[model samples]
Target: MELLQLQYFQVVARLEHMTEAARSLHVTQSSLSKTIQRLEEDLGVPLFDRRGRSLRLNTFGRTFLMRVNKALFELEQGRQEICDLSSPDRGSVELAVNTAGTLPAILKKFRGTQPFVHFHVQMLKVEEMHALLERGEVDFCLSSPPIRGDEIECQVMLLDSILVAVPITHPLCDKRSTTIAELKDETFVGLKRGYPTRDITDRICKSEGFVPKHVYEGDEPARLRALVEAEIGIAFVLESSTWGFREGKMKCIQIEQHDFVREIGLSWHKSRYLSKAAMAFRQIATDYFNS
Candidate 1:
């Protein structure tokens, strides 16, 4: 019934020579014999037909052997799968983030070094990221306006500047830079309220004396970027996220205010065990930003 008992039974059953099985198992013959004896007693049946120096499987032992072999094989497969999960070179990471800005670069860097590692990445609101991390649904979380709690551990991974992004043909694109006060009347595209970027933008705008007039709001930055691209509205975007702005149709301008910045951090539930992949990702993120 015990796994050890089943393993001993398997080795003994296969060799059909108790002495050889004991040596292969690195155990004394006497100890091996007692273990087999106990297993047979537990099953209430004899497992071997004994000969002087050799043991042969009896009819009942043969039938039981088939099922035992299958069970042992499956258990071994499970162990191998767990080992792969724990391995740094071959594993999967589950991550949630509030901003997608610096993430792709860090991920690209991680993939260059650990190409076999697979990823499950999500761009989520600040509240959603905290909830998922608390529930242990994700292994790591990258968030702006970083989350904290009794059950969570967090590290501020990066400090990113928020920039004003406008369509190439827009009037503000001609300016070297602009203040929140000067741009307050312009229509804006942004993430919805609960997102850290949205919250920060709102606070910064109010500190400059006006709530931004929203022309559109969404959860995804790409959508906001598209709206910016179409000249529908300018957007407050992370500097790292302005990747496509210059190459195609948008222009980016740095805002002078100190509040136009966000703290990006990595977080996880303190109670949840980190897989090697998640740990590697955490280190990679720290290195990427800290540099």
Candidate 2:
């Protein structure tokens, strides 16, 4: 019933362990248990199914947890709004990104204009970015294959060409441009599954009636240059990333197919409120990409 009770419940529901949840909340286990007991009594139903030392959210608990999350989110948004109103020129923007290649330049430009504004950025996978956007947790998401949903407003800011990077000595480098089918037999050095680039390129390969054979699966696309330069495996390189590659070591050949392009965009939950600083950051990002 009390705000403190709801907050404690949220932590407990997330951790699912009394000792761990109590430690996280910085409260004694007995006190946390008493608070949860009081909350369950107030609601006239047990929220979690207990098994010795572990706890699992039951059907009622799952349903109630969703509402609790929304309520807490709204309260936090209200607090942020008040802070923004008091200091319109100085506020934090919580942003999540799928592709990190172009973010540094964009952020540097944003900071140049609004030096006082704070940016809290996270590099997230597509699904993680979507969850944060839907929960009103992030102010905006700069993602490739932009986050899509009925409640989200997504705009494509950059259409980066996806190119196949091969070692300078490789046979493919002899051609000016190549198609996905031609690279089907080549060993690929790609980002792991769940990455937007990996997913987008994977789909393109699938449509070409072949699956890419990945010799090295990594998290950073920049590292692909080293692997390709060593002639270990070729990679699908974003056009933006080709800037860092040494020219004579590797060649980034254009994907002749039209579908082999990455769509990088900014997305946000349409219902979520954007502060002055967040809005300014959004505008700066749009202009930076467009220019």
Strongest candidate by lDDT = 2
lDDT of 1 by residue, 39-117 (tens): 9999999999997877999998999887887677557545545866667488778888866767888999889878998
Q: What 10-residue stretch in candidate 1 is worst by lDDT? A: 72-81
Error of 2 at 228 (Å): 2.3
RMSD values for the candidates in order, in angstroms, are: 16.3, 2.4
lDDT of 2 by residue, 1-291 (tens): 999999999989978999999999999999999999999999999999999989999998999999998898889889999999999889899999867877888899889989999999998788888988987889999988888899999989988888888898999888999877787788989899988778888887888889999989988776888898899999987887766556888898887855677898899988788999888888989988888
lDDT of 1 at 210: 91
Which residue pairs in candidate 1 collide? none
- Cα-lDDT of candidate 1: 0.82
**C-alpha lDDT of candidate 2 relative to the true structure:** 0.88
Q: Distance from true position, residue 211, model 1, in Å?
A: 2.1
The true-versus-predicted C-alpha distance at residue 114 of model 2, in Å, is: 1.7
Deviating ranges (above 4 Å) for candidate 2: 207-209, 243-246
The deviation in Å at residue 147 for candidate 1 is 1.6
